[model samples]
Target: MARTEFPAKATHAQTRAHNASLVLRALYDLGPISRAAIARLTGLTRTSVGELVAELEQDGLAQEVGRGPSTGGKAPTLVSLIDDARHMVTLDLGERTFTAALLNLRGEIQRRATRNLDGADGDAAVALVHDLIDELLAGPHSPILGIGVGTPGIVDSEGTIRWAVNLSWTDLPLGKRLAAHYNLPTVVANDSRAAAFATFLFEGEDRPTNLIAIKVGHGIGAGLVLDGQLFDGDGFGAGEIGHIVIEPDGAPCHCGRFGCLETVASVPAILRRAFFQAAESGVRIPQSIEAIAAAAAAGDELALGVVRAAGRALGMAVASLTGALDVRRIVVLGSATVLGEPWFEAIRDEARRRTLATLARDTEVVNGGPADDAVLLGTCALLLTRELGLTVRR
Candidate 1:
C-alpha cells in the first residue's frame, strides 16, 4: 500500500514572500547599496540576495545605479529602487469630501482628485467613490500596485465599514467590492489610524517606537501606534476615545451617546459653543474655523473661552489616554489645530493638571502642522507597508 501523504502548507512559498518583502524593503530604504550589503543587513545568503535582486530588476522595480568604493576588494555594484515603477491609488473618505491621489512607491503624490459629498449617502456615496477611482485610473500612470482607502468609520480587518454616520455607511463590504471590481489588491482602514501611521512613518528615520496621534476635526478620534505597529485592539476600536463620555449630561453625539468627548472636543462642538456664546453676548457670529481662530488670536473673550473649553475637554481625553497607555509622544492634528496657541495651551495645561506629575512632566503634546492632506498620505503609507513591506520602523 502507498503511504498516505498529507498535504503540507506552502511553507516555502511563504518564506519566499517574506524574503522578497525583506529585499524590497532594503532596496527601498537603503538603495544604492550592494547585494553584499543587503545580504549582510537582511541575514540572507549572497546567492539568495542576487536571485532576489535579479527578480526585482526584471520587474523594473530596481536597477543597478553605479559602483561603490572598494573596501580592500573589488568595487561593488550598487542597485537602487525605481520610485515610480508602480503607482497606487489612495483615497481619503472625509466627512464632507472624498479625496483621491496617485502616489508612487515613495509616497509622493503624482495626481489628485476630489469629490464633494453634497449630502450624498448610501449608494450615492459609493457611486461617488467609484467615479473618483474611475477618473483617476483613466489617466496616464504607471502600473497600479493596489488601492488604499482611508475612510472615516469603524472599519474591520476585512475592510468592511461597520458604521460611518456622515456617509451613512453600514456593514459595507467596500474592500472586497473594490478589489473585485478593479481586479487588484485593496486595503481599507480607519482614517484616524491611517493618519497616525502616516505621522509615524513620515517622521523620517527618527520616528518613535510608540505614538498616539489624535485627529480633532469635524469629529474627534485617535490612532495608537504601539511598539512600531498599529494596534487595532480586540474589537478594532482601540483608539476610539471620541465616544468616551466626558460629560454625563452634555450634548448628544452622532453615535447616539450623550456627553461624549466628541460632543465637547470636536470642531463642530467648538463651533456650536462659539455660536451660542457669541449669540448670548450679542457678538458677531463666527461662521468658520478660520474666523474663530482669528478672534481667539485677537483675544476675543468669547472665542478664547470656547477654545479653552474645547481644548480642556480634549485634554481630559489626553490625560486618560496617557495615563492608561503611558505613551509620551502625542500629536494633535486636523482642522482644529488652526486654533493655535490658546487652544494648545489650554490642552497642555489641562492634561498636566489631570495626569500624574511624573507622567505629565514627560509627555509632549504638540501640533501635527498643516495636515490637511494627512488622510491621503496616510492611505499611501498603508499601501506601501502592506504591499511592499516598507514599514515605518525604518
Candidate 2:
C-alpha cells in the first residue's frame, strides 16, 4: 500500500487568502451580483463577502456596476470585476519564434509582439525573450499584475527549467531571475501544461472536471487537468510525455534517448518522414506541413501515409494516457493540427484499436484547430489563476 501525504495546515494568512480567493472567484464568474448572492454561492458569511468586496473595490479590481432587480423590499447593489484592472505580460517561447503579449484581466490580448528565434539557443534565446518583453512593456498597458511564461521543458514549481533540450537550457532559474529583474510575481511552466489549463479554461461554462491536452509541434507533450485543477506530479514533470520512448531502435532524440514520442509525432518528425517519402517516390519534396496537408487532401498516397503515420503515433500515446487516467476529453493542438481529417481519423482509429472497448467508446479526441495563440493565452491563464485567484474552484 502507498502512503499518502497531506498538505500543511493553512495559517491565518493562508486562510484569509483562500477566503478572499473564493469571494473574488464568485464575483469573477458570477459578478454584477449582490453581496448576499455571493455569500450564498460561496457559502461565506455576508460580512466576509462584504469585507472582501471592499478590499477588491479599494484595489480597483471590483466596483459597483449597478443595482439588481428587487427580490423583495429593495434593490441590492451589484458588484462586478474590473476586467482590465490589471495587465499580464505573457510569453510563449516557441521552438521557432518567441511571442509576447499584453493582456487584460479577462485574458484579452491588447497588444502583441513576436521575435523569430532563427535558430538561437542558450543565452541567445534568453536574450530574445528579454527583447520581446522589453518591447511589449514599453507600450501602454494597465498596471502590471505579473509575468507568465510557457516554455518547452521540464519546469519545477519555482520556475526553474530543469531542462529544455532544444534551447540547451539546464537547471536555469528563469522564473526567479525574471521576477527579480521585473520586481513582479512570475510563473514558468511547461508549454503543454499551460496549454492544457488554457483549454480547460477556454471551455468557460462547460469546463470539464478532467481533461488532457496534448500539444504536437516541434515537440510532443501533454498537460493533465484533474478535478478542475492542473495536476503537477511530485516533481512537476507530470506531463513530460514527449520523451516517452516509443521505439527502442529508432531515430535519436535531443534528450539523448532513442525513438521518443517527439521523434515520431512532432512536426519535425512528420516533416522528415514526409520529405523522405516524397523523395523516394520521386514526388515534389514538400517544404511545409501545409503543403503536405494539401497533397494529402488531394489524395497523395505518400503525403497521406506520412500524416497518418504521425497521427497513429500520437493516437497510441493518447491510448496510453486514457488507459492510465481514464480522462475522456482529449484535445490535440499546435502546429500539427493542420494535418486535418485524414490525420485525425488515423489517430482515432489507432486510439480505438489500442484502448479497451469500454474506454475507447467514451474517449473523444478533438483538434483544437489553429490554436496559434494557445501558449500565449495559456501563460495568461496561469498568471490569472495564480495572481488574481480568478479560476480557483471552491
For residues 35-91, write the lDDT of model 2, one tens digit per residue: 999999989899989999999899999999889999888999999989888898999
User: Candidate 1 clashing pairs?
Assistant: none
Stretches of model 1 off by over 4 angstroms after superposition: 1-9, 72-74, 392-394
Supply the global lDDT for candidate 2: 0.89
User: What is the overall TM-score of model 2 with all chains considered together?
Assistant: 0.92
Off by over 4 Å in 2: 1-15, 43-47, 392-394
Taking all chains together, each candidate's TM-score versus the true structure is 0.95, 0.92
lDDT of candidate 1 over 1-394, digit per residue (tens): 9997655667777888899889999998788899999999999999999999999999999999989999989999999999999999999888888999998888788999999999999999999999989999999999999999998889999999998887889999999999999998999999999999889887866778999999989888799999989999998888988899999999987888799998998888888998999899998999998899999999988899999999999999999999999999999999999999999999999999999999999999989975877787787878777788776332
Q: Residue 211 of model 2: what lDDT? A: 98
Give the backbone clash total of model 1. 0
Worst 10 residues of 1 by lDDT: 385-394
